[model samples]
Target: MINTGKQAQLAQLKDSNAQLLKRLTARESRLNRIGMGIDAASQEAFEAFADGINGIAQGVEKTLRNERDAEAEKLTNEATAARRSSTHTSSDTAIADIMQDVKGCIEEQYLAAEKNLQVLASILGFFVDVDAVLAGCISVKDTQIFIRRSILAELSAFDCIFAAYNKIPNGSQIAVQTAHSRNGVPRDYVEDHYTQRTTKGGLLISEACIIHDEAHGMDHAPGIYTDEQISKWKTIVDAVHARGGLFFNQIIALGRVADPNFLDAQLKGPSNDVYRDREVKEMSVDDIHRFVQHFKQAAVNAMHGASFDGVEIHGANGYLIDQFIQKQTNKRTDEYSAETLKLPKEILDAVVQAIGASKTGVRMSPFSAWQGMRGDYDPVDQFEPWVRHIVSTYKDLAYVHFVDPLAGSSQEDFRKSDYLKKIVRDAGITVVSNSDLTLEMANERASKYGEAVAFGKLFISNPDLPARARNGWPLNEDYDRTSFYGGTEKGYTDYPFYK
Candidate 1:
């Protein structure tokens, strides 16, 4: 009986243990279901959150797309209107069509500018002045010359040799002014004296070659205008004036501050050194002041005898004034520091004081690296300060001339031109824009900013550029590049007229 009772107790204990194991397994299965439900809910929440974010992003993108489309449509309408209103002849239209190969070139420039505007808007918002931000394009040497020649060709197509000051009798010889002496004591009855003589019939001055150096030397090749050559130039000036043409003085290559040897050491390249060394330094504030005074006197003299409206200092073409004003080239520790630096203020102040504010004008080449100039500074760093300085200091200047960077170069670095233009316009000055601008491009640029645009090469070939542009005539190509400098007629007088 005792053994049987012990076996029953053991069985009861085993059953109880089995029951506990089953309960534990059921609890674990319930806990797993609860965990799975929580995980599913979290994943669903995440998916919904991601979907909402994507929706908002899509809306913003649509809004931007709509805005861009509207802007593009507006631009397209303006461009179309410009094309339709242009009074081009059938032949001109044909030529323009042929020139369509260059349309992409033109459009590239336009698009680059548009993109720059977008970036500026994003950074500064739409409230900024677009005009002030879009200063006119910079002028290039090739483009300027092309425009100049084109204008000349169109205007003076009939003249075989359209010489401005063409003739002066025996202009090659020098003449002296002398006074008669009274005879007296046996020592010396007649007073004998001699002096260096001035050329008879005034000097024939054509293009003004403004040298930027310590000594203000004339850079025109020797035979172009000797004391003898002056007579012929004077005649040309007089004749042109008589014909209602205005004679202006352009200062060329007038910005060598230091001695050539010094510049050679600091700057690179032998060609640069040669030019710099040859440059007699006449670009200091004091020197520029004196030069302006001389110019004033010369202008008065020229006006007294011939037709003269006014005088313009050749502040363009990377001359001394431009070098000093630009930040990259002007590494001076003295008063003429970078535009951001305060030194230029004193130098500019002196210039303003010396040359009357009304008579003076400053020219800058922010993007141009002409004559080995490397404006390595940030474009804004280089331009903003300079523009600000000009605006604040020389408020009365006639105008500011900006030489736009070359087209190919600008394409390589699109931001350069835009940055420069923005700085200039923001400064609040009348800007004369120049570049390799075709007639259409020039007109578009001018229309955009209401600024005067100068076409160098076109001006050269078509002297009547203004009229040709107005009439929409086809421009004559420049045939002789060699005759561009120090030559008599091949490129200068050979182009024929449309009529």
Candidate 2:
């Protein structure tokens, strides 16, 4: 049943916003004369904002003008859409809950918009009344309902699946399920996988691409080391760009994680650690310098040769860098063990020096024991100084990608990433979190904590995640955990978008 009182309130709010848009548009002619020091982009953005509000008002007016029966049908459809976004919600407050999501987003965007408005208006060499300018606008509470009833969760898609990398080749020509599995470089499939999940301004981080031949831990995983590999990857990246998505290649060196099955004498790490019966040759100082150069060159391969938007240093999840940071593994007495940050700083410096800070990012899972990063390892205590160093040293770097607790870890398991997030926040830098996240939780993090939330599994199943979320389309729940890793199209590109 429709809430008649709420419906009436929405109608009034719609009319108020319409008037507000009218007032805003009335100042358009002044853009030519005394527009002050506002840049062209700001003026255009304000106009677009007015246009958006006007469109919403126009939509509401058309719906409200319908007959009572039609109005009921519209309300039913709208509420049903909201229900689909939160499939778990079965209460009467679904609409109210949806408003909270929008209100959170509105507060963030409004404050930013407000700052720009004040900054531009105050530079006029005279007193300018911002309130008088937006006087016809509806109340915040009412506006939240208005916007929620229109646009839902389409804020950002910042997920990175470990399977987000390119596929395996026919190792030893083994027979496979799909023919796509047999061929090396599933270019079309890889492109489709990424392109399907992409939305304008949304970020998609690729699977850990190998930095060098010996850096690989698994068979047939993608690498950014060669010209052919870079060329093939460029096709995938170009497809993502064509769909208005931002693509980043997360580069990694497996270190001791390389198994005896895949790597030969080339296996290397900071210490002579044995992983899965594979002996890791202790990397000499010169060897360490070579890996640094490899990362720098891989970054160059990613951004320049492959045309990727950026490169993410895979410093977490027990990779080469994490191995060096681990106290149990880094048993060196030389300058390499000066601090736990020696290898990381060298690699970060080399990559940033090669590609520039704006195009480089780093991910750290200090609390995660995913790759032997266990101990009395206090994430805040151990990683805080490194985070501080990053903030002071690499100004204007892309972002610090932090992982929340891995699956099955409690909030206090290794300590929440809230402290690390605060460190990044205090530095006024962008902090992105990629892990298991729902739309509502993601919105809370992105809006409240200023962390860009990235969904991994949800994105694997929902390619049009942003659109499906906004319109409240049902998500596909048919996922195979076995097929979650590098495999055929069973759980890959074959997952259909919302029709």
Candidate 3:
């Protein structure tokens, strides 16, 4: 931040900063401050972080340079002599130990000062002469690692990753699990889990909820059809709303994929097919008509009864709607089988009619082979028309979330969602791209395609994921995969937050 018009002044400033950094890697460095300094925390860089430091006075610069050089030189000479002594530890080991301390300071606690645009934007592109500053303490390679674990790596990587899209929101998704209580009622702790992840102005899509009793997919999973179900869900919706967040419940019907003994009702799909050794009755035209009505009523129940901001039609992951859309699942010779998209489109029309286009969204996985589902024709040939049709028909559809081929199936090899990037953007609908996206990948997708990316597994352990990403905090990596499904609050709500 020390400004200079001439090369001599700039070189002098970098040298001064290098000396200061060397002092920080010593045994006596402090961690309880906003910026690096050997003594009590200095306001120099923080002021640069606040208002720009356009230029430095020559006399002050000279004084700082001389003091830092003398101190750093003395420390290095003493450290070298100690390394040669049999009674003392090697200087390299000591320096490495101290660097670890500094690294922890950056990773776990450096962002403790405050998080705001004025501060972040100013520091977004900060740089240092890495080799010169960290020369004696660590090698060039290790210095880069230290920087990557620092605040500069987080914000500087993308100048406006958050700033450009502050008003538009991105968020995490809660996948359905069998952890709730009996009768499909959401547990208070589960509701509390959602509340912990909710940030003001962020989007949250709930775990898949059954649309009706016949749509039951898993044991103890929540539903939106019944009075008790809606009331319980309202508790969660109110909490999310209070945090200024938008909550959408994903509504699904398992159809032939449902566990036959558990549904206690007839399993219906486009054909009488065997799934996981259980046979299902082929849906009649009348039966298809009824499920359409069921989906429509469920959407109404979500928005009106439960107060969800919208409903994401679960036409993905080889569920009921997805079954109808895929060629392998819909084998009927009746009118219902003539067009595979008919059932899903009818359901979409009903939901849009009830909830309006702006409050409706759809999630699909045309490339998924989960539950024995795959696309008609080629995968792209099969789903491109469907994507085009949906965006064209429902212009204001809230979003179309797609599980990338890589995340959804094994047979897809390394397929990319390249075909989808433009269609969703051209329609002006927000595209919520999901799957195993790291922080870097999410920012790339967001900038390239104007997407609102969603994270699932990462949020399982890091409850305050948005805050972590905002201030360059490391994500907690100790999630219990065993406890991710049906478990107590240990792995559910006890994940630690970085302070």
Candidate 4:
């Protein structure tokens, strides 16, 4: 009589478990209905979706746990009865099947939720209206409520919320040109293209413009101190301005990397370390003063003569400025020590003073030791402090361009770009992301980080990169590596305009 009672209870538990599964299935259906016509594109939408998922996930887990407990009880009773009867009939397979189904269902739901989040993030990148949706959002919970309300309200103006919070102008979204040369100035190499009509006309299709001007220390390159160099740059600047494009002149001062043969007899850096064939001389106070003067003069030259929209201080990519910034090369006890940041501070101050704060920008490659500039300490520990210091000091500058950490050998696990952004977001300066970025990446990153994108090689082969990106046209990947530097019209001006 006891065995009969136990079997009857086990049967009731199975029936109850089946009803639970049916209810879970119905809950999933209801959740799906809630998600209908709801796509998360911005931070607001994403948070809303995450909140909904979390609540539903908790409910599902609770339901599954109850079902599992009842199932376990049924199995235990069956096993006890089997042992007493000495029949040794096994219901182990059926119990195992029930457990497996529950596990699979939970796993599937979690995976589906993850996939949905990814889809929403991608959609947010390409299609969200930033103005309408992102406006006046105070908190994550509030944002969630807004997303739900927006859907139910059928707000027609909701399209405004999807606009990327981009500070850059529309036509000049992609900058093809970069600071890759010291010997060849864009003005001299591509003279014909710098005419007012040609430039303005071409810029109608182009996005942002980065004029890779000469690094300051190289004698072969145009130095801002000279009248001749200023004249050439002026011509290009006026033309680009006429076209209504934002033109930035990249000015660099190669410190340790300055070739002794090409620059001073003995190259100067923060340390006395030997690089390649030359032993770098540590800069004295006098040297720092002289360098700062040159930087200031260069800014004065570029600003006064060419009327450039802005000047990008080339402080990255293993250049002289980078040597002073990195600990490996910058091991001095003076004010210019790796910890002090006095050298870059003075140089930046001089440049900013010469050119107003609104027209001065700084570019840094914190995660890159490119051109044999390996720092002695961890890149993160070394750069994080400096970023905080610089943002505090020069909060009003135009922008801070950081070469993407993913592009270099410094560190991959840490996103130095995002880290810097977190520190500088409230500082009121734009952060530009550069190094090996394509059109799709530019758009995605701009949407994700709310920053501008700088292109290097893509701009080299395709002059009309902005138009190509907009129209989804095929780009010319063919670029002559041999004729990249110090070349005539062969590789410079010879790249045909898009037909």
Supply every candidate's count of residue pairs whose N, Cα or C atoms clash at under 3 angstroms.
66, 1, 0, 15
Write down the lDDT of every candidate, Cα atoms only. 0.39, 0.64, 0.61, 0.54
lDDT of 3 by residue, 1-499 (tens): 1113333544654565455445433312322221212222223433442222112223334433543454466467767777677466454564444445434433322133223212432332122223332223432212121111111111122211111110001011123432322266676676777788776545678888888877764655577888877888898899977865667788889898887544756877778878787878898787778788989999999999999877889888888888887777888666556264788889999999999776777888766777887734466665776788898898667678887766445544334366664677666556667777777787787656556677777776788887887788998877667766644566767777787
Every model's TM-score = 0.47, 0.66, 0.63, 0.59
| Best-to-worst TM-score order | 2, 3, 4, 1
Residues 1-499, candidate 4, lDDT per residue (tens digit)?
A: 1233334434553444344345434533433443323333443444544543453355355546645675677778777888899666466675666556655665565555445444543543222222222221221111121222121111111111110111111111112343323333334433433331132212111211222222234433444455655676677667665543445566677777766545523577778878887787887788778777877777777778766555777788888778888887888877778888787888888888888665677778777767777555667677777678777887556667777766443444245557776575545455666666666667776555445556655665666665566567888888767755543455555566676
Q: Alpha carbon lDDT of residue 198, candidate 1?
A: 8
lDDT-wise, the better of 3 and 4 is 3
RMSD (Å) per prediction: 31.4, 16.7, 16.9, 21.4
Over 4 Å off, model 2: 1-186, 338-340, 413-415
Give, for candidate 2, the lowest lDDT window spanning 10 residues.
Answer: 144-153
lDDT of 1 by residue, 247-331 (tens): 4333333345333331222322111234544533223445445544444444433333322222344444455555655654565
* Per-residue lDDT of candidate 2, residues 84-200 (tens digit): 885443443545554454445444544544554455433321122345433443321122100101111112222221224333322212224443221123344666688877765
Better of 2 and 4 by TM-score: 2
CA deviation > 4 Å runs, candidate 1? 1-206, 211-238, 252-307, 339-356, 411-419, 422-428
Model 2 residue 379 CA deviation (Å) reads 2.5
